[model samples]
Target chain A: MTERLTLALDAMGGDHAPAMVVRGAEIARTRYPQVDFIFFGRESEISPLLDRMKKLKAVSRIVHTDEAVSSDDRPSVALRNRRSSSMRMALDSVKEGAAKATISAGNTGALMAMAKFVLKTLPGVDRPAIASFFPTLRGETVMLDLGANVQCDARNLVQFTVMGNAFARSVLGIKEPTYGLLNVGSEELKGHEILHEARQELSGLNLPGRFHGFVEGDDITKGTVDVVVTDGFTGNVALKTAEGTAKLYTEFLRGTFRSSLLASIGYLLARPAMRKLLKRVDPRRYNGAVFLGLNGITVKSHGGTDALGFAHAIGVAVDLARNGCLETMGRDFKAVDRSTPDEPAQAAAV
Target chain B: MTERLTLALDAMGGDHAPAMVVRGAEIARTRYPQVDFIFFGRESEISPLLDRMKKLKAVSRIVHTDEAVSSDDRPSVALRNRRSSSMRMALDSVKEGAAKATISAGNTGALMAMAKFVLKTLPGVDRPAIASFFPTLRGETVMLDLGANVQCDARNLVQFTVMGNAFARSVLGIKEPTYGLLNVGSEELKGHEILHEARQELSGLNLPGRFHGFVEGDDITKGTVDVVVTDGFTGNVALKTAEGTAKLYTEFLRGTFRSSLLASIGYLLARPAMRKLLKRVDPRRYNGAVFLGLNGITVKSHGGTDALGFAHAIGVAVDLARNGCLETMGRDFKAVDRSTPDEPAQAAAV
Candidate 1:
């Protein structure tokens, strides 16, 4: 527990890049004092920012990489051409055992492709899933396959369930998490054929977490389960829809506060309370999207996030790394893979 | 436009049942003075409720039906056995041309099933889609296939686009409404094979509204397009996710307002402005889910909505009937059917 953990940061990634990465490392250093960093980017750009933060500079070193993956680069194009890019190099650090994890805010597709190529998937996992925690009424729920595998089979969903369960136990510190498959309805007869196959497979397995069967999209915000597993297509849409609704709500509040003199006065009086609520539901708190089921940990930060948000992403990587989430998933999924030896009911394959 | 329109009501449906139906009809009577209602349920229950509202009784007549579709009844069970159900009678009225449309707050599956069997789909439409309008930043956006078809092919998606476009123009009064296919990403090559096929088909067709290509889930609330088309599964999940997020925001607001005495005073002063915001985003304002592509209009109200919400649903049916939405859709689909005669690229069939 006292051992120092090193995290690789893609210093040239995101909107604010090197500055945000350096400042974020400084903020994270205070919270996780045992954590160190390897910043990957052009030293000329990163060095200046690091020089301003002595605390981060003390435990961090720069790995020079002139090339960086552009935000618009496709996964295949980035993987083939941008081999020496900051994002790829950062992931390489994790593969090379120079760091416990990698954190990046670059192109999501490029990051995923590079991470998979460099670190590889765990023994029992067919694909890596993007897992993130969402704030709900009761607490937080971790949903996986946010946008990784668009066309997931029953096996992929089961693997996601295993990965998400491992995530909850390792990072969230839940002794035994409860998981559910995200569907249009909670009925046993709901959703695609693959979902039913996945449910049947999960029901047969003696997993660490309890399987709650099918749950609707509303169950994510209701905190009905610790983990919600879904295909990347639906997960991505659901996540974005929730984000959009939240933004719309904020806009409505702003318009309300500006409508009249009394409302303006009211906003001023309620500023303190409103600040507390804002902090509680702040997107920055949930900025990190963890690439689960990989041999090495990789966290994707929101591209437009500030230093504080990047720091949150760093904390997520640190938590997953420290808790040995990869190993936990490996062990749990090994048992599942043994029980379910054949992947016969692959609807997509048919 | 000057003709008096009649809407059939499933008076024994919903959580509130005959009482809410009678009250809602009274409210709608005031709004649409030329609209009349034929209440289908037990006359003993309907007569007593209508007696309390003289205005509703003046323009409405009760059609006694002993049987009613239970909330828990499966679609197949309801369709086979519940032949004399109030919901069935309501649809029957529409088929008999006794009512211009049917308004039901009953089981959604049962309503859709009965409506399809009684009224049938419009010519050239293989399946009907659930269409609803969402409150968006720019105004309102019409989205289709909310929960009707769990699995849809490219042809189904193209048909949904057609229905949604007609809905926007005829009901929402949007001239040349722009539409987008909901996908994981806005990129050209993002989602499943079906999405690609659907996009290709939409692109080639000379649609009533302009096709804006793929749109992410967030675009729905952003009002990026006037209409959105997706399979029922994804659409249902996204819609529910947005609703859940909205509910969470309200809970957060309530918690903030009750956190301190200053906040309580602020809330009192801000009540008027908050009311305005609430009214604008009210679920009641968007209560009706229309079954598009049907030969006749069928509006389904939220089963748990109050009198006001039910009244809003009635308004939806009235609007659709008055605007000849079914005929408009029929005309639009006829052109699409002629152009896209062969459904050769149906991935689901393969």
Candidate 2:
């Protein structure tokens, strides 16, 4: 595990390309010396940052690609015209088995699309989902379909649930991750037909993890289930809402501390624990955007991220790769088929 | 205006019963002398609390009733069986023009059911929604359909949208409340079929507020939308997620501050500002739950609430009564015909 982790850093991607990406790569090298990185943008963009990165660790490879993927570049267009782009070539490297994983901080849609296209789906995976760990009241909750597969069908959602469970167990180290459908309510008949249908489909699937019935937004915070599954729209909304509220709450708390002279001193005394908690819940620390259901490990860092964020993304990729996530997922899917082929109509009833 | 605000309090319902109800009434009376109260419940439950209430404030009347509605009781059954129950009778007081509004910390379904039965829907209003205000990062956002109509059609959602718009304006004093349909994304085409239909309906309707397209859960915290409209299930999820996350965040902050000595001192200095924020965002201060789509003003406080929470509910009721909320809603509904004069296809489509 301490051995070198070769990561193809898509330096040309992200808003603060090259600089932040290069810095993040350097950080990853120093903190995790076992992890070696390749800078994948144009030589001009990567050269200046080389000095800063030298302070942390030396880079082994520099795949010079003149092409860069702008945040605004259309995904299809990027894939078509910029086949030689750094992001594309980085994935090509991963495909060629040069790197264990490829990391990018570019347009999520484009990255996911290209990643899916290049990596392809593993056996039995209809599609890949993006699952992330959120800081909730109870504990970390894994939510899927944050921005992948927006208009998903019942089968799509059921698969999302399966992938999510596999993810929580593999990455988060949870055993038998509890899976729950994210809906407006818990009642079997409460939400729309899709979720209702999904509930039925899930009921009969004989999934590897425990099906904890349906959960709502608050349920995410309650930690009622380990893996919460939903379509990208609702899941994305829930994730962003939690993130925004966390930031807002932090801002308000700091201001409250500074308002009064005495309270200001109290805030000073409480800074250590407070900062710890803030960072604990900071969305950036959990900076991982996993392309689930894919044949290979592709992690997308936040586009507007800092050096530290990219390092975290690499950490996530390392975890996924070492954990045999794909193999485990295939096993889970096989379990579904082997356990219950009948799938009684009444078995899926809400 | 404060002097004229009188509220009828339901004593028999809720999880805590007469003690919390009597305590809440006393607290409201002490805080707002303009506020008078009439307690309706079993005489046995009210007699003992009269002297204690007198110690806090003067009680004008106590209407004796033997029936009580359980939280799980069906709305219709509760409404029928509890013909003279405290909740129904209190609502009757509001309908008969004796009190500005009736407040219940009881079964939410029964409260809405009885209110609708006795007070009736406002002209042109097809359905009523449950609405509450959330303190967001920017300022505040109003969310509706917390749990009113579980299985809402596009039409019901439209009505919820209408109610949310008026509530934001009247209660929050917001001008041209920015309305957003809570969905996964901002795209016009994204969402469940009902939501998709409602999106079109909302876009086409010439309403009082500005429809700023579809707002996601994060938009609530971003302060992009003044009114976040959703079905009861989604609304409840969003609201509860906000609530649970806020609590968890504060808890984490508290733990962080308490972890070490130096940070503890920092917490002291920042205590005033933090206290101000905690006060402003405190859930209890914004406890009153308004039942929209009713002919008269009504508020549902949390079943397990204190005097402060009840006082907030009274404050909400006072605002609605003073602002002619019922009349405004009636006028808005009049502008949009509830019953279709034609277009059977439209109704079916809706």
Candidate 3:
């Protein structure tokens, strides 16, 4: 366990926290013996699950964090006031060098605030961007700013492009990933002022082989572009909308199948294919978003997500921490890969 | 045959110019013979369709335009180049008072450009905004700037607010439509400067109703908020993403339904309900986007859409023209109702 990449799970984060969080960590420990883990939250709330996991040969330690951060509380205030909150303590482990990364299935704002405060921003990084692996109809696309800095400046967007590109290459096995700035139109005058300037910066970046031009929302599911960059606000909306619509549509099919006998039979026979399709679009498997620009690695899962989903996030944190992704991004930002298309479009504007 | 609303159709404007446009119009015409129409496009291309419609007891007229607008052309250039494009001629009718409102299934950019040129902007309005109606899970919600103006100033957002409130009232039948600015987060400081100012203005709009602070992207379907507002650039992306995802998800359902013999039987029994559900989410049915802020009525339909979809757009145009929506919005902007909760918030801003 000493040589393994250690993770601290925030047991009291997310809609189904402590219970699902403990279960997910337990599964990860048993599945990946090389991974070390610590569960942080109220002892009474976590002990039962810890006992069960220990019985299942999952982990060796669990720390009690009696305080909790409410989803509605202002992130900065919650982090500063709730000293023993699970989210804060998990983040503290990363700061104290006990854990290489932390996983939180709690309030995104609170997690981001705590991570930035405890772990601090990686050097030469303006902001820590959020990037996720999305299962698109056209294979998969690595997307950034899924809910980090929503109102992004030209510099913020540029940083997202750089970090996202590194993620696509290192984690997604993408080769010479194409970069796209999400805009309403593909024209030079298609987006807001920041987008306009981002285009100019990206053009001047002189990366090894960056893709040209803009992409729209449809492109995310279409795979016409590789690395999609957007402000966190729009990106969050796009992701959530996509998820909600997919769910509604799935319900429509279920109703159709249940309406009659023949349709029921057809649904049963086609069940495998339907399941495959569902698996393909499932966020759980693709459930990883590295909070880039953080000195220590951090990954945040959806608030209401289940165990399998949290495990997927852990997989991402493990890969990132193991590969020294933060260092790579730092190098990428510091002008190490000038010839690589993954570098910033312009020199850091700081 | 004379009872239904007579619509002016831009038959030569879309990607399937003249042909599919003619057939779609025929479908609409046949479905409602009382619905008369004016088809504008090349005489040669439209003549045969007119003859067929006449055989089907569907009355229709044709106006010949010598040119067409392509997808790639610039919006402004498309309008200037197509001096006699069918889309333009249809608008001419609306202007000359020949038609109540013009309906175009053409290059949306071209249709929007030509529409603004021929119809002109309303007083106190700098540009006409685009709006899309969604049969939301909660109710009908109007999402605007669904791709009209790319970049907007804080002032433009205010104008859009006034107009969207009007559109929601006119089309959705909501006495006081709730206004929400699209952003990453709901907090006042979550967006760009203009949006930040927009929040203050929105909070202070006093537009005869309530201003629901700010709403994020996923709120569009959650029924949490009513009227979603943004610049055309972002609005357009959001609209298309919703439409595209809707289509893809529905297709996934169809694939499930057709999977087996038993499912086929179930499909038969569910046919009625399935159609009802499809109708609930049909993008074509929710096709028209009113060009708000325009002095005269103009409606834009998806360029690749069918005639029935265009028919719906025609209906929207009729509704706006009849209701004098712009003037209604003007009044609301000038005065928020005393009983409305948002009145105080909008008082100083308006």
The candidate maximizing lDDT is 1
Chain A alone, TM-score per model: 0.95, 0.92, 0.90
- Using all chains and alpha carbons, the TM-scores for the candidates as numbered come to 0.96, 0.90, 0.87
**Alpha carbon lDDT at A183, candidate 1:** 90
Over the stretch B19-97, how does candidate 1's per-residue lDDT look in tens digits? 9988999889999999989999999989988888888888999999899999888888989999999999999989999
Best by TM-score: 1
Candidate 2 residue A161 C-alpha distance from true site, Å: 2.3
Can you tell me which runs of candidate 1 are displaced by over 4 Å? A186-189, A338-350, B186-189, B340-350
After superposing candidate 3, which stretches have Cα over 4 Å from the reference?
A1-3, A56-58, A82-84, A186-189, A204-212, A258-288, A335-350, B1-6, B55-58, B78-81, B186-189, B203-210, B247-282, B318-350
Instruction: Sort the candidates on DockQ, descending order.
Output: 1, 2, 3
The stretch of ten residues in a row with the least summed lDDT in candidate 1 chain A is A339-348
TM-score of model 3, chain A?
A: 0.90
| Candidates in descending lDDT order | 1, 2, 3
Residues A161-195 of candidate 2: C-alpha lDDT, one tens digit per residue: 88888888888888777889987652322576888
Q: Candidates' DockQ values? A: 0.61, 0.51, 0.37
Per-residue accuracy of model 3 over A14-49 as CA lDDT, tens digit each: 888878887777667666678878888888877876
Q: What is each candidate's fraction of native interface contacts (fnat)?
A: 0.71, 0.69, 0.34
Q: How well does model 1 score by local distance difference test?
A: 0.90
